[model samples]
Target: SQTIHQWPATLVQPVGSPLSLECTVEGTSNPNLYWYRQAAGRGLQLLFYSVGIGQISSEVPQNLSASRPQDRQFILSSKKLLLSDSGFYLCAWTENYEQYFGPGTRLTVT
Candidate 1:
Protein backbone atom coordinates (compact mmCIF):
# COMPACT_ATOMS: atom_id res chain seq x y z
CA SER A 1 0.00 0.00 0.00
CA GLN A 2 2.15 2.83 -1.25
CA THR A 3 0.99 6.41 -1.40
CA ILE A 4 2.71 9.38 -2.98
CA HIS A 5 2.34 12.92 -1.70
CA GLN A 6 3.12 16.33 -3.21
CA TRP A 7 2.86 19.69 -1.55
CA PRO A 8 1.80 23.23 -2.43
CA ALA A 9 -1.05 22.04 -4.63
CA THR A 10 -0.87 25.37 -6.47
CA LEU A 11 1.92 27.88 -6.86
CA VAL A 12 2.22 31.39 -8.27
CA GLN A 13 5.67 32.87 -8.73
CA PRO A 14 7.30 35.55 -10.80
CA VAL A 15 9.88 34.86 -13.43
CA GLY A 16 13.47 34.52 -12.20
CA SER A 17 12.31 33.40 -8.75
CA PRO A 18 13.38 30.19 -7.13
CA LEU A 19 11.09 27.15 -6.80
CA SER A 20 11.02 23.97 -4.80
CA LEU A 21 8.53 21.15 -5.05
CA GLU A 22 8.64 18.11 -2.83
CA CYS A 23 7.39 14.57 -3.26
CA THR A 24 7.50 11.68 -0.83
CA VAL A 25 6.36 8.08 -0.85
CA GLU A 26 4.90 6.16 2.04
CA GLY A 27 4.71 2.38 2.52
CA THR A 28 7.22 1.79 -0.19
CA SER A 29 10.98 1.50 -0.27
CA ASN A 30 13.38 1.81 -3.16
CA PRO A 31 10.65 2.50 -5.64
CA ASN A 32 11.48 4.18 -8.93
CA LEU A 33 10.40 7.78 -8.64
CA TYR A 34 9.75 10.19 -11.47
CA TRP A 35 8.94 13.84 -12.10
CA TYR A 36 6.71 14.95 -14.92
CA ARG A 37 5.25 18.16 -16.27
CA GLN A 38 2.04 18.35 -18.23
CA ALA A 39 0.65 21.34 -20.03
CA ALA A 40 -3.07 21.96 -20.12
CA GLY A 41 -4.74 19.13 -22.03
CA ARG A 42 -1.42 17.84 -23.25
CA GLY A 43 0.63 14.72 -22.63
CA LEU A 44 3.00 14.50 -19.70
CA GLN A 45 6.67 15.14 -20.30
CA LEU A 46 9.19 13.28 -18.21
CA LEU A 47 11.57 15.53 -16.35
CA PHE A 48 13.64 13.44 -13.94
CA TYR A 49 13.82 9.98 -12.46
CA SER A 50 15.60 8.10 -9.68
CA VAL A 51 16.40 4.43 -9.40
CA GLY A 52 17.87 4.73 -5.92
CA ILE A 53 18.83 7.25 -3.32
CA GLY A 54 21.33 9.82 -4.61
CA GLN A 55 20.91 8.57 -8.16
CA ILE A 56 19.00 10.86 -10.47
CA SER A 57 18.68 10.92 -14.24
CA SER A 58 17.34 13.68 -16.46
CA GLU A 59 14.96 12.77 -19.22
CA VAL A 60 15.13 16.05 -21.09
CA PRO A 61 16.94 19.36 -21.13
CA GLN A 62 15.22 21.95 -19.03
CA ASN A 63 15.72 24.70 -16.46
CA LEU A 64 14.96 22.40 -13.52
CA SER A 65 16.84 19.85 -11.46
CA ALA A 66 16.01 16.96 -9.16
CA SER A 67 17.49 15.24 -6.14
CA ARG A 68 16.91 12.10 -4.12
CA PRO A 69 18.11 12.80 -0.62
CA GLN A 70 16.43 9.78 0.94
CA ASP A 71 15.05 6.45 -0.14
CA ARG A 72 11.54 7.82 -0.31
CA GLN A 73 12.05 11.53 -0.73
CA PHE A 74 12.48 13.20 -4.12
CA ILE A 75 12.75 16.90 -4.71
CA LEU A 76 12.45 19.17 -7.74
CA SER A 77 14.16 22.54 -7.63
CA SER A 78 15.03 25.45 -9.84
CA LYS A 79 17.15 28.48 -9.05
CA LYS A 80 15.22 30.59 -11.53
CA LEU A 81 11.90 29.91 -13.16
CA LEU A 82 10.76 31.05 -16.58
CA LEU A 83 7.38 31.78 -18.10
CA SER A 84 7.56 28.52 -20.01
CA ASP A 85 7.96 26.67 -16.75
CA SER A 86 4.38 27.16 -15.77
CA GLY A 87 2.50 23.89 -15.88
CA PHE A 88 1.15 20.99 -13.83
CA TYR A 89 3.95 19.22 -12.06
CA LEU A 90 3.45 15.62 -11.04
CA CYS A 91 5.27 13.19 -8.78
CA ALA A 92 4.98 9.53 -9.48
CA TRP A 93 6.28 6.14 -8.39
CA THR A 94 6.47 2.82 -10.15
CA GLU A 95 5.56 -0.51 -8.62
CA ASN A 96 5.54 -3.70 -10.66
CA TYR A 97 5.71 -1.56 -13.80
CA GLU A 98 2.58 0.34 -12.86
CA GLN A 99 2.74 4.04 -12.14
CA TYR A 100 0.93 5.91 -9.41
CA PHE A 101 0.72 9.69 -9.43
CA GLY A 102 0.21 12.29 -6.76
CA PRO A 103 -2.39 15.05 -6.62
CA GLY A 104 -0.01 17.32 -8.56
CA THR A 105 1.10 20.95 -8.28
CA ARG A 106 -0.02 23.67 -10.63
CA LEU A 107 2.56 26.39 -11.18
CA THR A 108 1.90 29.78 -12.70
CA VAL A 109 4.86 31.93 -13.59
CA THR A 110 4.12 35.61 -14.01
Candidate 2:
Protein backbone atom coordinates (compact mmCIF):
# COMPACT_ATOMS: atom_id res chain seq x y z
CA SER A 1 0.00 0.00 0.00
CA GLN A 2 2.95 2.31 -0.52
CA THR A 3 2.30 5.40 -2.55
CA ILE A 4 4.84 7.91 -3.86
CA HIS A 5 4.18 11.61 -4.32
CA GLN A 6 6.12 14.36 -6.09
CA TRP A 7 5.43 18.05 -6.25
CA PRO A 8 5.00 20.95 -8.71
CA ALA A 9 4.42 18.58 -11.70
CA THR A 10 6.09 21.18 -13.92
CA LEU A 11 8.47 24.08 -13.46
CA VAL A 12 10.14 26.73 -15.59
CA GLN A 13 13.00 28.67 -14.12
CA PRO A 14 15.77 30.98 -15.14
CA VAL A 15 19.39 30.00 -14.98
CA GLY A 16 21.20 30.67 -11.69
CA SER A 17 18.01 30.33 -9.66
CA PRO A 18 17.40 27.83 -6.92
CA LEU A 19 15.52 24.57 -7.36
CA SER A 20 13.79 22.28 -4.95
CA LEU A 21 11.92 19.05 -5.75
CA GLU A 22 10.31 16.89 -3.15
CA CYS A 23 9.32 13.26 -2.89
CA THR A 24 7.58 11.33 -0.18
CA VAL A 25 6.42 7.77 0.30
CA GLU A 26 3.52 6.66 2.42
CA GLY A 27 2.52 3.31 3.92
CA THR A 28 6.06 2.06 3.99
CA SER A 29 8.84 1.93 6.57
CA ASN A 30 12.54 2.19 6.01
CA PRO A 31 12.07 2.21 2.29
CA ASN A 32 14.74 2.95 -0.28
CA LEU A 33 14.22 6.21 -2.16
CA TYR A 34 15.73 7.38 -5.43
CA TRP A 35 15.92 10.43 -7.67
CA TYR A 36 16.31 10.23 -11.43
CA ARG A 37 16.45 12.52 -14.41
CA GLN A 38 15.39 11.96 -18.00
CA ALA A 39 16.10 14.11 -20.98
CA ALA A 40 14.64 14.09 -24.46
CA GLY A 41 15.36 10.79 -26.18
CA ARG A 42 17.51 9.75 -23.24
CA GLY A 43 17.04 6.90 -20.81
CA LEU A 44 16.31 7.44 -17.15
CA GLN A 45 19.48 8.43 -15.35
CA LEU A 46 19.90 7.72 -11.69
CA LEU A 47 20.93 10.77 -9.73
CA PHE A 48 20.63 9.81 -6.11
CA TYR A 49 19.51 6.99 -3.85
CA SER A 50 18.91 6.67 -0.13
CA VAL A 51 19.25 3.37 1.65
CA GLY A 52 18.34 4.72 5.07
CA ILE A 53 17.87 7.95 6.92
CA GLY A 54 20.51 10.46 5.81
CA GLN A 55 22.31 7.85 3.70
CA ILE A 56 22.41 9.06 0.14
CA SER A 57 24.40 7.74 -2.80
CA SER A 58 25.13 9.87 -5.83
CA GLU A 59 25.24 8.17 -9.18
CA VAL A 60 26.19 11.15 -11.29
CA PRO A 61 28.08 14.35 -10.69
CA GLN A 62 26.05 17.43 -11.37
CA ASN A 63 24.95 20.71 -9.88
CA LEU A 64 22.42 19.00 -7.65
CA SER A 65 22.18 17.34 -4.27
CA ALA A 66 19.80 14.99 -2.49
CA SER A 67 18.79 14.67 1.13
CA ARG A 68 16.60 12.41 3.23
CA PRO A 69 15.25 14.66 5.93
CA GLN A 70 12.69 12.17 7.15
CA ASP A 71 12.28 8.45 6.85
CA ARG A 72 9.71 8.83 4.08
CA GLN A 73 10.81 12.11 2.59
CA PHE A 74 13.51 12.75 0.01
CA ILE A 75 14.49 16.06 -1.51
CA LEU A 76 16.55 17.19 -4.49
CA SER A 77 17.95 20.66 -4.50
CA SER A 78 20.19 22.93 -6.50
CA LYS A 79 21.79 26.08 -5.17
CA LYS A 80 21.97 27.59 -8.62
CA LEU A 81 20.54 26.14 -11.78
CA LEU A 82 22.01 25.92 -15.25
CA LEU A 83 20.51 25.60 -18.70
CA SER A 84 21.76 22.06 -18.89
CA ASP A 85 19.70 21.18 -15.81
CA SER A 86 16.48 21.06 -17.76
CA GLY A 87 14.88 17.65 -17.70
CA PHE A 88 12.14 15.48 -16.29
CA TYR A 89 12.74 14.71 -12.64
CA LEU A 90 11.45 11.48 -11.22
CA CYS A 91 11.22 10.14 -7.70
CA ALA A 92 10.90 6.49 -6.84
CA TRP A 93 10.85 4.07 -3.96
CA THR A 94 12.26 0.56 -3.96
CA GLU A 95 10.61 -2.54 -2.61
CA ASN A 96 12.31 -5.88 -2.92
CA TYR A 97 14.66 -4.37 -5.50
CA GLU A 98 11.83 -3.10 -7.70
CA GLN A 99 11.45 0.67 -8.03
CA TYR A 100 8.07 2.37 -8.38
CA PHE A 101 8.14 5.93 -9.66
CA GLY A 102 5.98 8.90 -8.92
CA PRO A 103 4.14 10.99 -11.50
CA GLY A 104 7.34 13.04 -12.07
CA THR A 105 8.19 16.72 -12.43
CA ARG A 106 9.21 18.40 -15.67
CA LEU A 107 11.72 21.21 -15.25
CA THR A 108 12.72 23.70 -17.88
CA VAL A 109 15.71 25.93 -17.31
CA THR A 110 15.93 28.95 -19.54
Candidate 3:
Protein backbone atom coordinates (compact mmCIF):
# COMPACT_ATOMS: atom_id res chain seq x y z
CA SER A 1 0.00 0.00 0.00
CA GLN A 2 1.14 3.57 -0.67
CA THR A 3 1.42 6.11 2.11
CA ILE A 4 2.23 9.79 2.15
CA HIS A 5 3.95 11.62 4.98
CA GLN A 6 4.37 15.24 6.01
CA TRP A 7 6.38 16.74 8.81
CA PRO A 8 5.73 19.41 11.42
CA ALA A 9 1.99 18.84 11.52
CA THR A 10 1.60 22.39 12.84
CA LEU A 11 3.84 25.41 12.85
CA VAL A 12 3.94 29.00 14.11
CA GLN A 13 6.61 31.30 12.78
CA PRO A 14 7.19 35.00 12.71
CA VAL A 15 6.97 36.98 9.51
CA GLY A 16 10.17 37.07 7.45
CA SER A 17 11.36 33.78 8.92
CA PRO A 18 12.53 30.99 6.71
CA LEU A 19 10.39 27.91 6.29
CA SER A 20 10.80 24.33 5.17
CA LEU A 21 8.24 21.57 4.87
CA GLU A 22 8.81 18.06 3.63
CA CYS A 23 6.68 15.40 2.03
CA THR A 24 7.43 11.85 1.03
CA VAL A 25 5.64 8.87 -0.37
CA GLU A 26 6.30 5.21 0.18
CA GLY A 27 5.40 2.23 -1.99
CA THR A 28 4.95 4.38 -5.05
CA SER A 29 7.34 5.18 -7.88
CA ASN A 30 7.22 8.05 -10.34
CA PRO A 31 3.88 9.24 -9.12
CA ASN A 32 2.64 12.68 -10.07
CA LEU A 33 3.35 14.77 -7.00
CA TYR A 34 1.68 18.01 -6.05
CA TRP A 35 1.70 20.69 -3.42
CA TYR A 36 -1.38 22.60 -2.43
CA ARG A 37 -2.32 25.33 0.00
CA GLN A 38 -5.64 26.21 1.53
CA ALA A 39 -6.41 29.38 3.35
CA ALA A 40 -8.78 29.40 6.29
CA GLY A 41 -12.17 28.25 5.05
CA ARG A 42 -11.03 28.53 1.44
CA GLY A 43 -10.69 26.00 -1.32
CA LEU A 44 -7.41 24.30 -2.06
CA GLN A 45 -4.97 26.09 -4.36
CA LEU A 46 -2.35 24.31 -6.41
CA LEU A 47 1.09 25.55 -5.59
CA PHE A 48 3.62 23.25 -7.21
CA TYR A 49 3.92 19.90 -8.93
CA SER A 50 6.57 17.56 -10.23
CA VAL A 51 6.59 14.87 -12.83
CA GLY A 52 10.15 13.73 -12.25
CA ILE A 53 13.23 14.45 -10.23
CA GLY A 54 14.40 18.09 -10.44
CA GLN A 55 11.25 19.00 -12.30
CA ILE A 56 8.83 21.50 -10.82
CA SER A 57 5.90 23.49 -12.08
CA SER A 58 4.25 26.42 -10.34
CA GLU A 59 0.55 26.92 -10.50
CA VAL A 60 0.44 30.40 -8.98
CA PRO A 61 2.83 33.27 -8.56
CA GLN A 62 3.90 33.41 -4.94
CA ASN A 63 6.81 33.60 -2.50
CA LEU A 64 7.13 29.83 -2.20
CA SER A 65 9.14 27.29 -4.18
CA ALA A 66 9.21 23.51 -4.42
CA SER A 67 11.85 20.92 -5.18
CA ARG A 68 11.74 17.26 -6.04
CA PRO A 69 15.16 15.88 -5.35
CA GLN A 70 14.13 12.25 -5.36
CA ASP A 71 11.46 10.08 -6.89
CA ARG A 72 9.41 10.10 -3.69
CA GLN A 73 10.57 13.16 -1.83
CA PHE A 74 9.20 16.68 -2.19
CA ILE A 75 10.17 19.77 -0.31
CA LEU A 76 8.54 23.19 -0.05
CA SER A 77 10.54 26.18 1.03
CA SER A 78 10.27 29.91 1.54
CA LYS A 79 13.18 32.29 1.99
CA LYS A 80 11.07 34.65 4.05
CA LEU A 81 7.54 33.80 4.95
CA LEU A 82 4.80 36.40 4.65
CA LEU A 83 1.89 36.82 7.00
CA SER A 84 -0.38 35.85 4.17
CA ASP A 85 1.53 32.58 3.80
CA SER A 86 -0.21 31.03 6.72
CA GLY A 87 -2.44 28.17 5.73
CA PHE A 88 -2.83 24.41 5.45
CA TYR A 89 -0.30 22.78 3.16
CA LEU A 90 -1.01 19.45 1.58
CA CYS A 91 1.14 16.98 -0.32
CA ALA A 92 -0.49 14.68 -2.78
CA TRP A 93 0.36 11.99 -5.29
CA THR A 94 -1.62 10.64 -8.19
CA GLU A 95 -2.13 7.01 -9.12
CA ASN A 96 -4.32 5.94 -12.00
CA TYR A 97 -5.60 9.52 -12.15
CA GLU A 98 -6.75 9.42 -8.55
CA GLN A 99 -5.07 11.61 -5.98
CA TYR A 100 -4.05 10.66 -2.45
CA PHE A 101 -3.17 13.31 0.13
CA GLY A 102 -1.03 13.47 3.21
CA PRO A 103 -2.29 14.54 6.61
CA GLY A 104 -1.17 18.15 5.87
CA THR A 105 0.70 20.84 7.73
CA ARG A 106 -0.96 23.87 9.26
CA LEU A 107 1.17 27.00 9.31
CA THR A 108 0.50 30.16 11.27
CA VAL A 109 2.60 33.19 10.41
CA THR A 110 2.83 35.85 13.09
Candidate 4:
Protein backbone atom coordinates (compact mmCIF):
# COMPACT_ATOMS: atom_id res chain seq x y z
CA SER A 1 0.00 0.00 0.00
CA GLN A 2 1.27 3.48 -0.87
CA THR A 3 0.77 6.45 1.42
CA ILE A 4 1.82 10.07 1.51
CA HIS A 5 2.53 12.36 4.46
CA GLN A 6 2.64 16.16 4.73
CA TRP A 7 3.46 18.19 7.78
CA PRO A 8 2.18 21.30 9.57
CA ALA A 9 -1.35 20.89 8.35
CA THR A 10 -1.74 24.67 8.46
CA LEU A 11 0.65 27.57 8.45
CA VAL A 12 0.60 31.35 8.97
CA GLN A 13 3.48 33.48 7.82
CA PRO A 14 4.28 37.08 7.04
CA VAL A 15 5.14 38.23 3.59
CA GLY A 16 8.83 37.90 2.58
CA SER A 17 9.47 35.07 5.02
CA PRO A 18 11.01 31.80 4.02
CA LEU A 19 8.90 28.72 3.53
CA SER A 20 9.59 25.02 3.60
CA LEU A 21 7.05 22.23 3.31
CA GLU A 22 7.89 18.56 3.12
CA CYS A 23 6.17 15.53 1.67
CA THR A 24 7.20 11.89 1.69
CA VAL A 25 5.80 8.67 0.32
CA GLU A 26 5.99 5.11 1.59
CA GLY A 27 5.50 1.77 -0.18
CA THR A 28 6.40 3.08 -3.61
CA SER A 29 9.52 3.70 -5.66
CA ASN A 30 10.30 6.13 -8.44
CA PRO A 31 6.72 7.35 -8.50
CA ASN A 32 5.90 10.63 -10.22
CA LEU A 33 5.71 13.33 -7.59
CA TYR A 34 3.75 16.53 -8.07
CA TRP A 35 3.06 19.77 -6.20
CA TYR A 36 -0.16 21.66 -6.72
CA ARG A 37 -1.64 24.83 -5.30
CA GLN A 38 -5.32 25.57 -5.06
CA ALA A 39 -6.48 29.09 -4.49
CA ALA A 40 -9.84 29.94 -3.03
CA GLY A 41 -12.59 28.86 -5.40
CA ARG A 42 -10.11 27.95 -8.12
CA GLY A 43 -8.91 24.73 -9.65
CA LEU A 44 -5.56 23.30 -8.68
CA GLN A 45 -2.50 24.68 -10.48
CA LEU A 46 0.60 22.56 -10.88
CA LEU A 47 3.66 24.01 -9.23
CA PHE A 48 6.22 21.33 -9.92
CA TYR A 49 6.74 17.66 -10.71
CA SER A 50 9.53 15.14 -10.64
CA VAL A 51 10.10 11.73 -12.16
CA GLY A 52 13.34 11.07 -10.29
CA ILE A 53 15.95 12.62 -8.10
CA GLY A 54 17.04 16.10 -9.18
CA GLN A 55 14.49 16.07 -12.00
CA ILE A 56 11.78 18.68 -11.61
CA SER A 57 9.36 20.36 -13.98
CA SER A 58 7.88 23.71 -13.07
CA GLU A 59 4.43 24.38 -14.36
CA VAL A 60 4.15 27.88 -12.99
CA PRO A 61 6.70 30.61 -12.46
CA GLN A 62 6.10 31.98 -9.04
CA ASN A 63 7.76 32.43 -5.70
CA LEU A 64 7.70 28.64 -5.19
CA SER A 65 10.33 26.04 -5.93
CA ALA A 66 10.48 22.27 -5.53
CA SER A 67 13.18 19.68 -5.08
CA ARG A 68 13.43 15.90 -4.94
CA PRO A 69 16.55 14.72 -3.18
CA GLN A 70 15.44 11.17 -2.36
CA ASP A 71 13.30 8.55 -3.98
CA ARG A 72 10.34 9.28 -1.69
CA GLN A 73 10.99 12.71 -0.34
CA PHE A 74 9.84 15.93 -1.98
CA ILE A 75 10.19 19.45 -0.71
CA LEU A 76 8.60 22.79 -1.60
CA SER A 77 10.37 25.97 -0.68
CA SER A 78 10.18 29.70 -1.11
CA LYS A 79 12.88 32.20 -0.27
CA LYS A 80 10.45 35.07 0.18
CA LEU A 81 6.83 34.36 0.59
CA LEU A 82 4.23 36.64 -1.00
CA LEU A 83 0.70 37.50 -0.06
CA SER A 84 -0.50 35.99 -3.31
CA ASP A 85 1.12 32.72 -2.36
CA SER A 86 -1.45 32.03 0.28
CA GLY A 87 -3.42 28.94 -0.61
CA PHE A 88 -3.74 25.19 -0.14
CA TYR A 89 -0.64 23.26 -1.03
CA LEU A 90 -0.94 19.61 -1.94
CA CYS A 91 1.49 16.85 -2.72
CA ALA A 92 0.48 13.98 -4.92
CA TRP A 93 1.78 10.85 -6.61
CA THR A 94 0.58 9.37 -9.86
CA GLU A 95 0.23 5.80 -10.96
CA ASN A 96 -0.62 6.42 -14.59
CA TYR A 97 -3.60 8.84 -14.55
CA GLU A 98 -4.70 7.85 -11.08
CA GLN A 99 -3.36 10.29 -8.53
CA TYR A 100 -3.37 10.14 -4.75
CA PHE A 101 -3.11 13.32 -2.71
CA GLY A 102 -1.85 14.15 0.72
CA PRO A 103 -3.92 15.88 3.37
CA GLY A 104 -2.64 19.25 2.10
CA THR A 105 -1.17 22.26 3.87
CA ARG A 106 -3.00 25.55 4.13
CA LEU A 107 -0.84 28.63 4.14
CA THR A 108 -1.89 32.15 5.03
CA VAL A 109 0.49 34.96 4.23
CA THR A 110 -0.12 38.36 5.74
Q: Among these predicted structures, which one has the highest lDDT?
A: 3
Q: In model 4, how large is the Cα lDDT of residue 99?
A: 94
Pairwise TM-score winner, candidates 1 and 3: 3
Tens-digit lDDT track of model 2 for 1-110: 88999998999999999999999999999999999999978999999999999999999999999999999999999999999999999999989889899999999999
Q: Candidate 1, overall lDDT?
A: 0.97
By TM-score, who's the top model here? Answer: 3
Residues 1-110 of candidate 3: C-alpha lDDT, one tens digit per residue:
99999998999999999999999999989989999999999999999999999999999999999999999999999999999999999999999889999999999999
In angstroms, the error of model 3 at 20 is: 0.5
lDDT for each residue of candidate 1 in 1-110, tens digit (9 for 90 to 100): 77899998999999999999999999988999999999988999999999999999999999999999999999999999999999999999999899999999999999
**What clash pairs does model 2 have?**
none
CA lDDT of every candidate: 0.97, 0.96, 0.97, 0.96
Between prediction 3 and prediction 4, the one with superior TM-score is 3
Clashes of each: 0, 0, 0, 0
Candidate 1 vs. true structure, TM-score = 0.98
Candidate 2 has a TM-score of 0.98
Per-candidate alpha-carbon RMSD to the true structure: 0.6, 0.6, 0.4, 0.7
